[model samples]
Target: MGCATPWCLATLVAIALALRSGYAVSGLVLVSGYYFPTARTDFWLTSAPAMPLLGDLMRYTSPPIISWAIMPKLMRTLFAPRAIPPEFKNEFPISLALRPKQLRAAAEESAFLIPAAAQLRLQYRVSGVQLGSCMERLTGSSRPTSRRLHAVLPSSLLHLVEDAGHMVTYADAAGIADAVAALAPSAPVRTA
Candidate 1:
C-alpha cells in the first residue's frame, strides 16, 4: 500500500499547488504516499471511522478497540527496515495517536486520498510534460504508481531509493535530507 505522512493532506496540497495559489510549491514529497485512487483491502478498516454519523460513534467504539490489538504490529510495520527508537517505545505519545478523535482524523484523511489523487491525475495535461515522481522501495502494489505517473507525465523523474517505505524519514534522515537538498535550486548540501 502506498502512503504519505497523511497523504490526504498531501493530496490537498497537490490540489492547491495545481490551482496555482498565492503560494508556490515546487513539488510534492511523498513518504509511503499513495498516488492512485485504487482500493485496498485495509481501506474499510481504516476508513470506517470516517463514515457519516456512525463515524463519530465508531471512533469511541469497535474500530479503536480493534486497533489497540493491532497497534504493536502496525507500529512495527510503519517503522520497518529500522528499529523503533527507545525514545518512541518509552515516551512517545502512543495514546494520543490512539485517541478517538485522532482516529477520526486519520480515517477521514485516508478516505480523502482516493478522490484527491483522481483529481490530480485528471488535472495533468496529456501534453507529454512531466513531474518528478519518487516512490517507496516497499509494497508490490506501490511499484505501479511511479509507472502510472510516468505514463501520464512522461518527463517524470523516477528516483527509486531502496527501502524508502513508511516512516523512512526516520529510517534514513540523512538520505532524506540529501534527497531534499538535491532537489533545491542550489547544489546539494551535506545533510548527515
Candidate 2:
C-alpha cells in the first residue's frame, strides 16, 4: 500500500513530463499495499528511490486533483457553443391557437398525464403526445394545440389514460389488458 503511493507518484510525474513534452500515455495502473506483494517490502526494496521522488513531485503540482487533471477538457467541450439549423425550429403556429388560460390549463393537465403515460407505456400506444411544456409556457397559446393532439388520439391509445390521476386504476388496467389482447394476433389453430 505504501509502495503504491511512490509508484503512483512516479506515474503522475511521468505523465506530467510526457504531457509537457507532447507525448501521450494511456491504460490503467494498479497498486496494492496489502494484497499480493507488499508495496514497502517488495516494490520499494526492489525499485529505485528516484521513482518515489517523481511521484512526490507530481503530488505537489496541484491541490484539487480533478481540476489539475480532467476539468479542462470538460470545460472546453461544454463552453464551446453550436448553431441550430433553421429547418429544426418550431413552425407549428402555436401563437395563433390558444389563450393564456387555456394554455395554462392544458400544461397543468399534460403535466399530470405525462408521468402516468410514461409509467403505463402509453406513448407506445399513442403518438403525437407533446411532453414538452416550455413552448406552452412561453407562447401561452400552444396548450390548446397540445390538448387537441391528446384528445384526438385514437381510443386504442386513450384506453391507457387513467381517470385516477397518474395511477392506473384496476378498471383501467383491465381495459388496457383487453385492448392489448384484442390487438394481439390469435394463436394459430392446432390440429391433432
Candidate 3:
C-alpha cells in the first residue's frame, strides 16, 4: 500500500538544514544512508535516462533491452543476504524509478550530494539532537562507511540488524520501528 523505504535523501537534507546556526531538530534516524559519496559507474549508466538526446531515446525505446534483463539481478543484489519481499517485487513500480523525469531527479540529487558533503564537511554545531544509524549487518552495502558516517554523525548510536544488508528497512520492520521509537521523545519534539 506504501513505499517500502523512506526517501533516504531526506537525511542529507536534514543534515544540511541542521548545520545552520540555531536550526532546531529534535531527532534524526539515519537508515542505511549515504554520506561523503563518490560517483559510481551506476551513476553514469542510470543517468542515461536523464541525458538530453539519450533521455528522449531512452523514454521512447521499448524494452530498455539491457535494464530489462539486468534489473532483477540488480534488485536482488540491492537486497542481498535477504530476499526481496513478494509485495515489493509485485507492487514496486520499477517504471516509476526508470521514468525519465524520476531518473533526472535522482541524477540531480546524486550530482548535488558531493558538493553538499564538501560544503558541510567538518562543520560543528552546538545542537545535540539525537542521531542514530540503522543497518543490517552484512558483508556489503551501499551505505556510507562507518568511519565516514561517524565523521558526519559523530554522536550517532549504531543499531545493527543481524543477517541483513542495506535493505534492512524490509528485513525487519519491527527492528526499524523499535529504533525509531528509541529515537522518539517521551514528550513532544519542539523545533526552533
Candidate 4:
C-alpha cells in the first residue's frame, strides 16, 4: 500500500521531468489504480461532497484551493495526531476516512504530494487509464463519475475493470495483476 504511492510518484515525476529535460523514457507503462489528477486542494473534497466539514477544512490548506480556508481547530487537528487502532489499518477507505490520525498522515503526504503531482500531470499530461471505468460499465456497481484519468492518461492504455472499487487490491486483485502483468515487462531489472 505504502510503496505503490512512492513508486508511481517517482516513476511519473521522473518520466515527466526526463521528458522536459530531454531524457529518454523507455518502455513506460503507467497503471494508476485511482488517481486524483487535479492538484487543486479541493480535488479530494469536491470528489466526495458527502465528506464531513472536517475533510473539506483539512484540504483547504493546499494551494489553489486555499480559498476553502481553515479554522483554528482545523489547524490544531492538522498538527495533532490522534491514536488509531491497529485494526483500522486493515479496513478499507473507512480506516482512512474515519480516523483523524490516518487522515493527518494522509493530509501531510497529500499536502505536498498532490500539488507536485498536479504540476507533473499538468505540465506533461501523460495518458493513462481511469480505474473507475471498471465499475461504471456495470449495472449495479458504483457510479460512473470518475473520468479524471482521461485528463492525465492516454485513452489507449486506459482500462476499467468491472465492479472494481476504491480498494482494488481486494475487490479485483486478479484483474489488477493481469493488467500489471500485461503492461509491465517480465525481465528483471539490470544493475550496474
lDDT of 4 by residue, 9-102 (tens): 4445544545554553333433332233443444454333224585555544442233224433442332223223244334424323434444
Clashes of each: 2, 3, 0, 7
> Could you tell me every candidate's TM-score relative to the true structure?
0.76, 0.19, 0.76, 0.41
Compared with the true structure, what per-residue lDDT tens digits does model 3 show for residues 60-136? 57425565677899788767778888999999988777665665666566556556655655553344665655443
lDDT sort, best first = 1, 3, 4, 2
Error of 3 at 7 (Å): 4.4
Candidate topping lDDT: 1
Task: Write candidate 2's Cα lDDT for 1-192 as tens digits.
Answer: 122222223323332343343443221121111111111343322222223455344333432343345534533322222222233224523333233333333333323232332343333234322221100111221123223323443331222231222112221445444544444345455799
Candidate 4 matches the true fold with a TM-score of: 0.41
Question: What is the model-wide C-alpha lDDT for candidate 1?
Answer: 0.62
The lDDT of each candidate is 0.62, 0.29, 0.60, 0.40
- Using alpha carbons, what is the TM-score of model 1? 0.76
Q: Give the better candidate number (1 or 4) by lDDT.
A: 1
After superposition on all CA atoms, what RMSD does each candidate show versus the true structure? 4.5, 28.9, 4.8, 10.9
Give the candidates in order of TM-score, highest first. Answer: 1, 3, 4, 2
Q: Which residue runs does candidate 2 get wrong by more than 4 Å?
A: 1-157, 160-162, 169-171, 187-192
Report the Cα lDDT for residue 154, model 3: 66
lDDT of 2: 0.29
